[model samples]
Target: MSNIINREIKEIIAYGTSTNPKISLSEDQAFNVLLLQYYCFKESDISKVWYEILSMITDGKDDGGIDAIYFDEEDSKIIILQNKYSNAIQVQDVVNEINKIIATMNDFKEAHTGSYNKKTKRLLQESLDRLTDENEGNVEILFSSLATIDIHKIKSKLLGIEDRVAYITVLNKGNIEEMIEKLQLQHEVVAEDSLYIDNTKNVLKYASDQHKGIFVNVSSESISRLYNKYNQKGLFNLNIRRYIRNKNVDDGIKNTLDNNRDEFWFLNNGLTIACTDFVEDGNKIRLYNFSIVNGGQTTNLIGEYKGKNRDEFYIPCKIVSSVDEVSSQDTMKFFNTIAEATNSQKPIQPKDLKSNSPEMRSLQTLLLKHRVFLEIKRGEKTAKDINIKIKNDELAQLIFSFVNQKPGTSRSNKNSLFNNNKFYKQIFFKRYSSEVEKTEFLLDLIELNDRYNTLQKKFKAELSDQFNLEQANIFNNGKFVLFALFGLSYRIINEDVEISSLKSNSSLIEDDDFIYGPFISNYKEDDIEQKLKDLITFFVNILDEEYTNQYENKKVTSVSNFFKTDKKYINDILKTTVNKLGRTYLYKEFLEYGQIFKRK
Candidate 1:
């Protein structure tokens, strides 16, 4: 083993044996801490990373060898993690553990129903519901160990045992060392001898003291070598869109490479490479800090065409190098711009461009004035001035739930919602048109939502059984109560004496002037404290009525199903109640219930 690998192994061992109050010998706790540290090393946002880790902890012994699980809802992939923190583990033991996991997943429903913890059972069932034959290839089993083992030999033995799985990988000391090296590389701006290209057959397209552009007619074999050397670590790191494995595109590339090598350049937009510096000597061009900002498909295809018709093709490439004295931030910005520009031919998700957008940057700056950190880029945790940072993904979800008024859509399709056009065209684009207005609007909305979440938890603990409803309703549909509170605020501000005016202005609830200027300005903390309980009581009464109605009409067998089936009716009732009662009557009713469920 290399010294780096030995060092990492030692670190893991030391952490495992530490007597810190937070550390524990339990397998689940140890694995959670270990994986948390691993992802932390990968530079994931600490808050979001901890959220994912906590979500996966099953909290019991009968976890069926599954320490933690993550479902990449976007890719429709399930990542099953198993960690063994030991100095030495036999190959057979590892193989047996993997086989056991495969069997358990194969019979997921049965295994989960038997003796597993409630949390793991629910997670397993939800995961099984998401998996179908079409996405069976998305399952990834990762086995991690502190020991050094021959991965190739183990993979050979485990071949074909679960052919349906996407793939399996073993994370040992070598893999940990590679991860550490990648992390280190992320901090450096300059690289030495980063790329190798031939100079004999290629021509210099443009040359200057500060910039150089070269056009190369390179063989697929050489391109494959370049990809093997750098692509895995961070060659296309700046590209916003990740490479999706498309069989059709791969086949087309291979066909074109085999049939028409000369026409490949015309038919395809050749690769665009950026480098900090390079030097040409004899037949070789050595590049520094080189990254491919475009042509990910072509690079991946070249790697795939490794053994078949590999040498029969040559593709064109455009290599651009710069030696100008630029700051690291400017260089990163330049690369990000190139990445966004080059990927125009492919479909880009909203999140792909949102980080660098002018609106987001303006909002980020505005948020900083309030001591709130807004993270525009995913997995970025560089904001050091605040205790809580709101990630772009989380902000998007909040916008979807609050502004778009589709909390159900946000709940079911959390991953897909950010990429959808409606989120951009209907909500984000409209709200961000006026930066100051939208900034205040979002700040108020987040504050209100946070308080609502806290009150919902308290309600569940204190009154869930008394209300005679499932605890799930308190967790899932609590957003409806928040929406009702917004409507109530409008009623209070308008002082229309009749609730009918609220119906016309209900759409105006999302309006910034209506929410921040009118509603927030008029209400005090004590008013909110009283109104929150009233809102909860209002929702409870509506749910109780719906339960009785459903039970009498035989429309549902369980009271929980009432929330699922009659959500529209519940919303309509809440709206109509606010409309009929007006602000004065509602305040009177709140005072009546105020003395009963008085705030602690």
Candidate 2:
């Protein structure tokens, strides 16, 4: 029994938050809440052999919200539980969750017993029909709580769900003996003979603001079941952001929380939900600072990044991720640890930015451009040569700054995005489960999706009455695609107007093809209004078969940056003399768009 329980505990701890001050609490607290739960049975439960049987479903969303299924293999019944830990608990939230599980289960069963082959289809007919009829899934919910919960309200809600969902609430204040006795008094589920725990820390350590440990308001069985599900399925682990669901609101909360969430975590976000704060830092000292902007523009703040604890003032940074993980083994160059102690733990102003290193120069230029990241580390190592320690320390600051800043830098996007995705097919279509079937399926799907996309784009543009030099994207929810292509090339097909943006000093539209703005101003009094209208009409009517023959096959491939690598036969017709109305920055948009696309 000890083996099973101990293994479960170990897994939880390994994946969960640690009391050690060095770990990223956002990652830790998520795992911490599930660690303290256990399923209990007397030392003689027979079906204990089936202890390993667990149920779990992978949610498309990446948050670690794993719904667990625990059941005795020998029995013909199943129990599903949704477990979560937070200081605040709402009864309505639980009721809504039970409904979601029922829907998911129904969908799963439908997939399982649906048509496979003729024989299987016949065999699964009854199942298919039965499964199609949604089951009012009676998964027992063991809603756990880590705080001093209001049980009266909880009991009332649980009774309302008595015919279906089961609720279990565990308060923070309860002795092991009391907890055990309470479990015995409740209804029993299938369990194993093995159950054991060693010297457990009753008091979970928190860096500052919240609880020391995650309270188990749910069942231990739920924990064991969830662990096994993850193990058996070889889960890649869910990320925090997918579950949290990013939005503009999240960013606002993020700023406020970073300054107050913890003495330990110090930064708001996800890590370190609870903390009995130690010496406070930025998260600790209240910043009564705000700038009065002229008019009603949003204001900014100026203050020293006071230590909320070791975490707040001094944060490390990774070039890509917003949350920084602390690790000694990951030490290498590309680290940018904070040198907060020397800077009086001051917040970085627009001016605290000077460096001698070339890499630092790169970072400085990037910062000046207000790209997404701004890094400055000490100890004279180039990005590749920087020690891991320096990297870890700077990582936190990088995350904080990136998270706080609006629409961060686009220069150093981490994800790989080839323009073609292997020419779209190469990027999107890979080896499917089976070549014949998958290829047919994907081809059909892609064609359909393309049609839908094209129509969607056309509808959008027609309604908006907006058209530019973008390529094929003038058809769907492909504003970016159109913007990108337009910045580079111009195409004309009858009334299907091709738009061109002037990125360089300027370029004139061909005799036929609608040209958008940003024309360079070459003369003081060029008849601009009449010239533009005349040019728009002239380009539209001039489209001809000869123009298509000359450049139709040429593809505007992105070479480097937003620069295009394409074979284009520029026509002298489009190069007719023009009084430039303005300087063009059309290509610059493509540059920025490329950077943004890379990030997504």
Candidate 3:
């Protein structure tokens, strides 16, 4: 395991150094970027581009213990990366770094001043400002190194102010080995155990020519004991998903255990274990190289239970094994099938079912031709060097918002978009014949959506005084609607369409047979930012004006809720926008932009 960890570290170092050799980074500097990509970002693979990785490095003169800082928008957490890529990491050094970071946070909160570098100061202040109770502000300190240290020893030295952060996770050698194992999709069994089968009770044994199984009941405590001893050692590696800790579900499990122990077996799903082989000698059954393929949640909760009656309940158990006649590949397939099938009925999201659909595969293949990886399945590994990766669900929502102009439905009922065949086909399937044409069209919309999201994040972070209250509300809450309107507004600018005609017909917004295409702009890459900003400002101001008018006339009460209704958008906002339009940014700046459907 230690050797494997060393190899992994060397690979990361090599990756970092070779990504941009011109930068001439030291081993420590390269390791900082490596940690930023792998540990801080929590991405098993390093998919970030070189420049983005370079921007995360803040380890230099006047730096405050933080080697790199990344804002994780998904969890609203500020991840501070502390890199110590050496085999001689000491607990004292780890403790000292934590104290320094705590002091830095205090200094930032009090005076918002620090001796850190300019980037560090700005990022730290921004992170600190966002650390409000309302926002559920969390700070995660990632102390990464090649060496393992006593975690309790380091935590014992911390003061009470450590509560200000969420958790300080140490990424050391053992963790590296685990990560590598997951990447390789191979879990090595580190231990094995046996169960005392009740000879007095009926133990039904089933056997095919090549496969075998046994069905019996075992004390819940026995299963819990197995989890307690080997849970951390990949005892549940074959389970479809890890034990997701849910307080409510856990409480219910405990309630059954404490108050209704007799009915536990009837209420809970039983465990399914898969092993290489099992030997039944009299009353003892020894499972060799086995893992629980299902019921991981119950196993974990039962393991955590400390009630005196934990041993009083019995749980149904099914054990499956294969003889020497079965090939290793067949055994693995059988185990994986059992894992997936058992968990498939557990409140699966609609998108999970569509991951392997024809539409998804088609889009994925089309995107791959352009050197882009479409992650149709969650946690699917793509090429490490692939710079562009898009999630299928996100792309679907983007198209629904921008092309279909159903931003409300896009947000409020995204699952339906995948569940409903008509909507799913409209978004994911292209009407065009040429794959190149389809890829280009989707790529253009993707680029526009990316720019829109970036601008929204910037506006939120900067809180520019330029946007009034109403405008800010619309910009923040009406993101999908705003993107839809931006596209419609661009069309109005370029096509020179009469707003009166659009308002009178209304089919453009209401029709189901409408075929939408990509928006082709004449502006250069460097000019896009300013143009997008100006266009956003202009559209947001109009949206605000219409919203305020509706509010003053008692037509609507809540601006946010108003934006959520598609009918309200069409009846009031769209009408007002078109009625008020004139020669705007489109005519003044560039000559033309057009919607493209085919190559010609």
lDDT tens readout by residue for model 2, 335-452 = 1111111212323322223234343444333323322223353333343332122221232222211211101111112111212122222222333323443333322222222333
**Lowest lDDT block of 10, candidate 3:** 590-599
* RMSD (Cα, Å) of model 3: 10.4
Report every candidate's CA lDDT.
Answer: 0.58, 0.27, 0.67
lDDT tens readout by residue for model 1, 1-600:
457644544554455465245544454364444554553224433333433455565535787777777666555667777777664887887898888778767666344356666566656555554554445446677787767888767887887764646557688766665655655454332254433344474566787775667777655666677776665567766555535544345557778877776677677777776777666655556667767778888888776452344444556677776658677777777666666777666545456676787767777776677777888765455666763467766666666554455544444445565567666555456554355555656666555556666776656435544554333433344454345444344435444223464466554433433332223423444667556656566656655565456545756433323332224433544455555455676657754533322211
How well does each candidate superpose onto the true structure, as a TM-score? 0.59, 0.21, 0.56
lDDT of 1 at 570: 32
RMSD of 2: 25.1
| Model 3: per-residue Cα lDDT over 1-600, one tens digit each | 366655555666667667557546666776776666555454546644444456556788777888887766544568888878687989888887887888777777676454777667755654554433433437777787877777657666654645677556677766665755654574555246887654635588899877789997767767777877886577877885656444345668888988898898798878888888887766667888788888888898788665566446778888888867466687778778877877665655689899887767777777776667888887677956564777887888777776677776775566778899999888876743265445555777677767767776665534345785457656656777777776565455545344667767544665534334445433434666666677667667788888777766757544545565567766777776665563466434322222221222
TM-score computed on alpha carbons, candidate 2: 0.21
Best by lDDT: 3
Candidate 2 wrongly placed segments (more than 4 Å): 1-11, 14-37, 40-66, 106-138, 158-160, 165-600
Worst 10 residues of 1 by lDDT: 557-566
